[model samples]
Target: MTKIECILRPGKLEDVKDSLNKYGIHGMTVTQVIGCGLQKGRKEVYRGTEYSINLLPKVKLEIVTKDEDVDEVVKIISQAARSGEIGDGKIFTYKIDNAIRIRTGETGEAAI
Candidate 1:
């Protein structure tokens, strides 16, 4: 199994989710996060003053899939999130040693 972690602009969440669902990836975890990359954040104006927003808001997705599904999943996310801009975000994939379902005591891919 492979674990795919995606950090994307908040506005792209819905599109990414829909694409993933249509592609048969139904399980995922989503979180609101704040971080900076090469974009180095951006400036914002509030109350007639300019402020450097060092950490921008982003959406983080955690999805675990069978090895064969890894490439497709990445492609789906990439297409859905692409904006041709600096802060479009990134995807990271890693090997998953095991997955266990506590309720049914299923392990390995069955748990996934």
Candidate 2:
């Protein structure tokens, strides 16, 4: 099993979600987040005052899937989130040791 986490510009969430659905990925966790990496955020002026916004709003998606689905999921998210500009965001994947469904008491692949 694997856990895929993607952080992208918030505006791309709907598109990414729709793509995931079209790809037959039904379950995921979505979170609104603030982060910075190479983009390092930006500067905005208000009332003639310049302010540096170090934390940019981003949409985070957490999906757990069988190992075979990792690459496809990543591809779907990358394609949907890309904008040919900076602050486009990033994706990370981790091996999942275990998973359980509380109501059904299912474990491993069945749980997910």
- Please tell me which predicted candidate would have the highest TM-score against the true structure: 1
Tens-digit lDDT string for candidate 2 (34-109): 9888887589999999999998889899999999989988999999999989889899999999999999999999
Question: Native-vs-model 1 lDDT?
Answer: 0.95
- Candidate 2 overall lDDT versus native: 0.93
Count clashing pairs, candidate 2: 0
Q: After superposition, how far is residue 22 of candidate 1 from its true place, in Å?
A: 0.4
In candidate 2, where is summed lDDT lowest over 10 consecutive residues?
33-42
Stretches of model 1 off by over 4 angstroms after superposition: 46-48
- TM-score: model 2 vs. ground truth: 0.93
Report lDDT (Cα) of residue 33, candidate 2. Answer: 92
Alpha carbon lDDT of each predicted model: 0.95, 0.93
